[model samples]
Target: MGKKTTHKFKAEVSQLLDILVHSLYTNKEIFLRELISNASDALEKARFKTQASGETDELAPEIRVTVDADAKTLTVTDTGVGMTRDELMRNIGTIAHSGTAELAKLAEQGKESLDSLIGRFGVGFYSVYMVADEVTVTTKSMDADARPIVWTSDGRTDYKLQELDEDRPHGTEITVSLKEDLASQFTNEAHLKHVVKTHSNFINFPIYVGGERVNTIQALWREPKFQIKAEQYAEFYKFLTFDSEDPFDTLHTSVDAPVQFNALMFIPRHGNDPFGLGRENRGLDLYVRRVLIEKQNKDLLPEYLGFIKGVVDTEDLPLNISRETLQDNLLMRKISSTLVKQVLDHLAKMAKDDADRYNEFWRAHGELFKAGYMDFLNKDKFAGLVRFNSSSLDDDKGLTSLADYIARAKEDQKEIYYAYGPSREALALSPHLEVFRRKHVEVLYLFEPIDEFVMDALREYEGCALVSAEHADMAKLDKFESMEKEDKPEPLSDEQKTELDKLLARMKDVLGDAVTEVKASTRLSESPVCLANPDGNVTSSMDKIMRVMSKDTSIPKKILEINPDHALIRNMLAILEKDENDPFIDQAANQLYESALLLEGYLTDPHALVGRVQDLLTKSSSWYVASGK
Candidate 1:
């Protein structure tokens, strides 16, 4: 047996102890969590030792925490790997074995904080000082020949180690003399049990608080998916997110090669902040060795997936000396990458297996998912996941994927076409989609403002360039033979074409720089006049959004396209040829341009158009009276 010995803590350890006692850990309650976690680790080490040594004695590894209000004492005992007197002196009394000397140096340099040192410095035992005035540890090594040892400290610069007189089992017990204020609450069995279940309930080993088993729920994420029942998954999801409804999607991911992690993530059916009044704090609860370390850690998933809730446990995470926060951002990014891929794969599978379910999910979260459309690395994947109302669909209830669009495209279709408007119904009524419908070409209906940005980022999908329906280059697209339209207008004769060219020139001269050009349209069917981008540049939807963002007042110049087959345009041309300078003729042409601008969403002043309509109405009434008289 060794004699009683007392020693002063190393200089760095003394400073570290000061930080732990006064400033370390945000919540004082975390001390219990840390202690329990350390006990679980010790039990795990012991179990492995028993396995390796082939010990015959049955080892029922367990952690027991007892609170005694009468004595103002809180005891945490674990049936696990115990330490010898030398180990106690080295591990607890000095900074030589504990990994906190660098932390102390960091604290000295003002680069580290007490909050940052709690979980990271391998000093979980010292956390007792946060709530305790004194701490004593009675421990006996797993070696049958070793004697029991007792260590005592007032959480100051010095500690005492002495040989224990009584014989005990191969385990460790730490007794903390709680401070006066904390003793009352901590000694209550219910409060202690709550703390145990809150943080360490998922520990593999049994945890008994006040002689009642507390860790009832196993870490289901660590279990194989086939073994877990559907009801269990639903219950787990409810527990994790606190939402009564089942998750829209569940992604269980386990990776071993790049980095070891077991993650079970759930896509929430609805966002907590439906109105988005405040930024929702969302992320996975990070766990290491089945013990909760960080809750709501946003770094585990990207911003687009903020609605995901779950647990991520990894043994390979390179935690900073304080296990409170992740040490490496690169490692976090890798984890995020893996999680995102798994989520995307799950969504893709859902899209394939059940269209209705996928559509429901899209209705709820599609807008949020658009945020990832610009991610260059995952643009292709996002494109496949995106769904939009297509001209080919009979109703707006169903949305078509890009792959479906590509698959159904005509053999000669060189580009994918899309139209942007406030809604599917509005887009279907667009003049831009006139020739597309005539040629039996499908056009995607982009409703949200972000839809344009998404399409812009996804300029091409599956080798087909995405072309806006309102662009002038669609004249070539008009040549595609259509089986749907039977009442096609005949091609204009050379003389009619010549006359149409003259009318276009006259309208262009009247409109001046307000438009780039005026031409007979091969794209329009019912509308008399519509505006288009002659340069095949920004679509009207994108133009409106950019103008709003930059607060630029200038309207983008557009090409005026007049449907030659329409009666209004034919009558305007006949009247203009007879009297090009006629006031009514000029009013008619300018009004047509304004109407096109309005349809293109470029008109800021409808008051001018209203006044022109009134003038036209008065003229028509006067003409009717003159004819009647």
Candidate 2:
């Protein structure tokens, strides 16, 4: 053995290592990932060197991870370019090249603290100390005449280096003698294989653990789109999600503007947590050069887009010591914003080019994606992707985008109209749709509770306000001409108008503060009555959602709009004209109020409705028999 030399780690570097081994122990398994990643990097550099020198090496680039159970040692070996004595000292023996010194200086200046520097640099090699008490690295450089060297460290203050007499393979091998308590954890073949598969499975070169190839799955996202086949994407999707079914759609994007990243995102055919169980925590796997930094990184995409799965590999992100997560939130946001925009662009394309597929996507994901209205920064793009069943569509299964709705809408339409109910069948019977139907205007049907919140969050899109149907009383729908229906009813005469005004007054007195106002509705066409939002700020849908969230079943007061042309209202007016205080008058007014509640989906109990209908039925039957029909 040649003379050995010892080098000391700076105090701050020592503290940083302590932080890595102890403070960042949320996942102790990540130490294995870091070592594998280092070996992979070394192998990549070796490949580049051989290619750059125009020399073909006999051996293909490889990484082997092995554990010695009896020895309690874990070793990671790589066929790559190795470093010399001076190079090892510069790279491993000192903190100079590793940015530890600069980070410490920054800490001294109070720009950042020593504790905060835990994951801000790439000193991943030291992570081995988390599981190992001692580490030995043996290497022979690719240089023809270079001598082999051994670098050994206890990961305390100092490390020593010695020159070896005999030559070895021109690559590096790192062996870590596991700490007694951690030996069983890493020495177990299955656990080590799992750690490798989870983190470094996508390494360009092959990775073998315990002499069996473990990382056989390629990093499909890193490949160019032209090189990828549809079958490959499908297979990759299955491997990624463990789903037997192929993805509904795959978006392979390489974004450069705002930030640079390569993302292969899969929209599943369907989600397990369709009801949003654990939805907020779902995220994409974030990778730096195909080595996973964070699994299910929630910051990459909002919970609303949690249905989207797969990997995001970006060179733009900086990893901390453990590579457990990213260093900067702003950089993450930039990537996230770019990814979201790209996804929206793809969906818009899908909507245009592949209507059938896009419709299926809407049906499967609308409940999940509609919640994205809270991302107000991308409101316009999100609006274009939002799909809703419209009044113009024959069935609830039919959907229309806000852009499409606007395209088919009357030119004078200034607001994007929407309504909420149990189903398309229920919304079709809604009195609020009367005027929209007459004017041939489309109204979005919101079936889920979340869609109400979506409309409230996104108040407008592309210069048009998102108006809920409950607030149709406030919309400017009178300007458009009504569609020609057979035998359109005449306007009420002045005398009858005076009588109807009296009826509205009587209804207010009968219903009291239960209604904000009782007025003849210009928006109502077929249905006799419907409820409206007196406080436009809180539409009926918004209020309903709020109540449900609060677990409150109590219905609040709303505006009552009546159609004078409807037979029910006309009969009520006749009863009021003949006898102002008749007991039947109060029954008629209260019945209409409850009927409006039923139409608006706020009627929890049908007992009152049942009693009213029976009373009307009894009187109609008696009248029918007395008339000798």
Candidate 3:
């Protein structure tokens, strides 16, 4: 051992240390990940240098981790190009090389922004302080003339460097003295192995724990698709997701166009945390040149893709001075945009190539796709990837793609129609869809509430407008029919219709603003009444979601459409002739309006509905008893 000289950290180094020790990272465990990543990077650098020099010797490229329980020390060794004495002083003693100086300047200037600093700095080295009290780095350069060097830092205010004459090999080794509280956990071989296996199993080089090789899983994202076998992919999925079941869908894509990237994404077989659980966080692991940058990085993918678990590797990322912050590099944004497009394209192709398999994926992740449609409303690329069950198709059948729906549209069809209800059966049986079904118009069945917003956002596909079947303009669809005017009978007599208008006005007064306008239904068949929204501003689905979010129970107003041909409508018209003053008749009409509102999924006062129904039932029972006796 050589004589050690103590030195104060640079002005900026002191500032960076203060920030890092205070609140730089949210999780302390991430310190291990950062150290492992640095080891991997060093190993990669050594391998590249060796390959360039065409030297093949005893120094093989690998990363080895050793835990010493008795000493309370953990060491990560890498067979890479070690630093010389001057290099050690520059790389370890000074924070300039790591870009910490730049960050300090930014902080001083009050221009601190994670977006610009992340990826440029190499602060990942300091994360060791979070768990360790002292760190020592021993390195021997590849040059035979260069002597070994040791750099030591207690992470307080100073560090030391000196020349050493130990019989060290040509590589780097980092030893950390575990903090007293964490010493026991670090001493456990099993615990250390588990952490290595969980976070660094796919590292390109082998990682050994307790003198035993631990990392056996291959980095499949780095391998060519043709070289990867199905079993290998399955195993990789199982490892990446930590799931026993196989993935429902897997997309492995590599592109160089907008940005160079490699991605291996999988849709889980089960929907464990769907519905957002609060707000969904991004689950994709981000990497730069096969080295892990962040696990479950929230910025790599959109929030709607939280269900997807995968790895994305790119070489063009701009890491901050500490390699801790991920700065907003244009390259990263380009890569992100390209990745989203590629996933959407892959889904579209899968739906076309194998409908059955794609249906399974849709069943598991369809809600996420719907969410993407709602949140990324302007992302038509993602919108085109959505699939839905259609009333036009058979039950227990495959989903309808947006492109397929467009291809099957009639030449004169001005809109792509859709209907939302609780389920496929409910939508198909809805009186709202009766007119479209009669005209042989295919209506897409939307069972989920979010689907309404999705359809609204994707208003037009292939130049055809997306029209909800319950929209008031659906009445205009009748004009598109080739039926002659003489074929269909007039709705009602002019005088009876005039009287009916007066009746609707009186009912609207009783119902207050709840009824926008009560009109004769042109869309209903078996159902006595239904509701329609003429002003497309707010759909029933939006109302439902808002009500749940606000926890408010106030009912929204809606227009009532009474089917003229239905038996209930005929009876009400007859009752108006002899019983204009009958309280039972008024109760029945009001109940019919309220029932229509309920069926349409509008907000309604349930207590008022119950009272009206009871009154009508009592009046009918009394009339029956009076006539019989």
Candidate 4:
């Protein structure tokens, strides 16, 4: 041992310490992850250097973590190219050159390669003091002539450095005297294992927890896409998602321009927490040069892609900057936006190139895309990636992209029409589709509630407007002429029709302003009555979402359209002619309107519906008794 010279922190370092201790980071547990990540980086660098130079006697690269529960101390040791006495003082004791500032300067100079600059910053080392009361660093550089060095700091305002005289092995060991409250975390093997697995599992070098190798999976992000085997991807998926089933799809890609990034994204076979009662999805993990920075980085991908789990490793990330408090940093924003675009493009390409695999992915996570389309309307890049089932395609029951729909549109069609309901069958049976179906116009059938909002936001695709089938003006569509030009079916004589209209006006008075209008509908073929929100004030899809969100079933008011060609309407008209005072006719008409509202997914009073059905059945029974008995 030599004389340990205690030195005060550099002015910049002392200020940085105050900020880190008081305001920089929000979560203290992040300190362990940061320190571990730094150690892993060092080990990886040493491995690479040894491979290149072939100078080291022991070429094995490994990171080992040991915990002393009784003494409340934790140590992380790595067989890496450690720092010399002078290097240790320069690297750990002072803020020599800020990594982020250097990156910015490099950007200005148009120099993009930052791979060798992984551990250049000194801030991450200080993070250990967040959880530990004292930290000791023992390091021996790869240079044979250099002496081993030991650095000590109590996380106050000063640190001490000395040259060690003991014949110690090469590499570095960091020991932390943990705070009392944080000791439990270090003592629990399970907790430490989870932290290591989450943050350092994909480190380029092996990581050992208690002398057992914990990181068995390779860092696929660092490898070439073609080099990855299927089993390797499956194992990585299992490690990332904790899923036993194989992933539906995986996108492995790297980009250098704008921002350097390496992403290995996997779409799981099933979504996270399907019932909606469990925790919200955490999105993807974020890494910087194989070190886990953010476990659940929602900013990396849109919320709709929560089903995707994988690792994104970037060497250019400013890790010292708080991701939570990141403001208008244009570089990070560009990186995030670029990543999202790349993901969307990858998905689109997959759907086009490998239809079968993309279909499987859509089956597992199509609703998430729909939800994203609605929530991230401003992200048109993602919106263009959305896919849904269309009434046009029969061979492909899976999904149809907006681009495909645009390509298949009619030559003269000005808009893309869509209808949303509970299911494909329900949408096929919808009365609103009669005119479009007859015209041979393909309508996109939306089964999810978010589809409406998606369409509303999209509004148009490739210069074509997205129009809903339920629009009142849609009834007057001239594209499809009636098959037969027979005169309109006469429901009642002119005088009688006028009298019925007057009666309906009186009924409207009784019903208050619950209806927009009562009109004879030409859109219906078999249905007696239907509701339309032509102006889309309270769209049927919106109503359904509100009901689902609120858990309420009360029906709202609507515009009722009666089909003049329907036998039920004609019979009611004749019944009123015989006796205008017949209350049964009024009840039947009201019941027909209520039934249409229900079919349209509007909220209605069930008691009123049941009472009307019971009354109608009783009337039929009485009529049968009067005629036969």
lDDT of each: 0.80, 0.80, 0.74, 0.72
User: TM-score of the candidate numbered 2?
Assistant: 0.89
Q: After superposition, how far is residue 572 of candidate 2 from its true place, in Å?
A: 4.2
Scored against the true structure, residue 56 in model 3 reaches a CA lDDT of 76
- Report residue 513 deviation for candidate 3 (angstroms): 6.3
lDDT tens digits by residue: candidate 3, 35-74? 7777787777777777888987587778777878889998
Over the stretch 193-249, how does candidate 4's per-residue lDDT look in tens digits? 887786677777777778788878778889998888988898888877778888877
Can you give the TM-score per candidate against the true fold? 0.91, 0.89, 0.81, 0.78
Please tell me which predicted candidate would have the highest lDDT against the true structure. 1
**Ranking according to TM-score, highest score first:** 1, 2, 3, 4
Instruction: Please report how far candidate 4 places residue 211 from its true position, in Å.
Output: 4.3
Residues 1-629, model 1: lDDT tens digits: 56888889877777776766665445678788878887888888898888899875466899999988899999999988999877778778765444555765755754246555544556666767878899999999888777999898898878888887778888889999998978998899999898887788899999998899998887999999999887888899987777889887777778885788999888888754533742356878998889887888878776666767899998876543346677666777887888888888788889999988988988887877777776788887788899998888888777989889989999877788888887777777788887777778888888888889888899999888998877737657756776564544565678667778888888888889999988888778878888887667888888788889999988788888899988787777667667767677667789998987787777888998999999989988999999997
Instruction: For model 2, name the residue pairs that clash.
Output: 119-320, 119-321
Worst 10 residues of 1 by lDDT: 271-280
Q: Runs in model 1 with CA error above 4 Å?
A: 56-59, 96-104, 109-112, 115-120, 180-185, 188-191, 270-281, 320-322, 482-513, 621-629
Question: RMSD, each candidate, Å?
Answer: 3.1, 3.6, 4.8, 6.8
What TM-score should be assigned to candidate 3?
0.81
